[model samples]
Target: MEAKQLNIGDNVKKFRELKGFTREQMADYLNLSVSAYGNIERNKTDLTVSRIQQIAEILEVDLAQTLNFDASQVFNITHNEVIQGMHSKVENHNHPDEYKEKYIKMMENEIARLKKLAGEA
Candidate 1:
């Protein structure tokens, strides 16, 4: 769905409920009143960048996912330059030719690289 069509507040509310939290509980976690939190999820209130960030963290999700933000448009705009840089860096790295021939080892290395890029490792 288009980012503009997606309701960020609705996504947040859905996630909170899926995690078994009531509006009061989520409000308590965010140091907001139940009425304020209700407004947020209902999109009756405006959420600032800092508030959205805080909500993303509390929900343990990325801002893009929380907002249903379309990231591909952004990436596409920068891809020519950024992908070129990544390609050059990858080429400079010395990996074994024999390792490339092995499926398991290559998969492991790919996973490691992805994790590192995502800051999960």
Candidate 2:
């Protein structure tokens, strides 16, 4: 399905509703007076970068998603699950026994150095 096009007010309102926040509640969270925040949601004011960041955090969205309102683009650019899975697989590789031994030894040495530096050796 084609993603719905959302303007700034649409994004703001959608996210607020998704989070179950009314304009007054969201304004309280933003430390803005209700009228000021209402202006933002009504598209009468531009969102500053800091405000956008704050709204993204409040909406539990990424900065890009708040600014662009492109849900697909947001997911594509910021998906962490795939990357984390790949990293986990690589870290658990059943490599040559010799390689595993070397990796362990390296880690041990690093830990020993850290302990010594911290006077905890």
| Candidate 1: regions farther than 4 A off | 1-6, 69-121
lDDT of 2 by residue, 1-121 (tens): 9986546776777556434456876776777899999888888887778888877766667877776655343222211121221222111223344434544565587679989999998
Residue-level lDDT for 102 in candidate 2: 44
**TM-scores, each model vs. reference:** 0.52, 0.51
Give each model's whole-structure lDDT.
0.59, 0.61
By TM-score, the best candidate is 1
Clashes of 1: 0
Q: Give RMSD (Å) of candidate 2 vs. truth.
A: 20.7
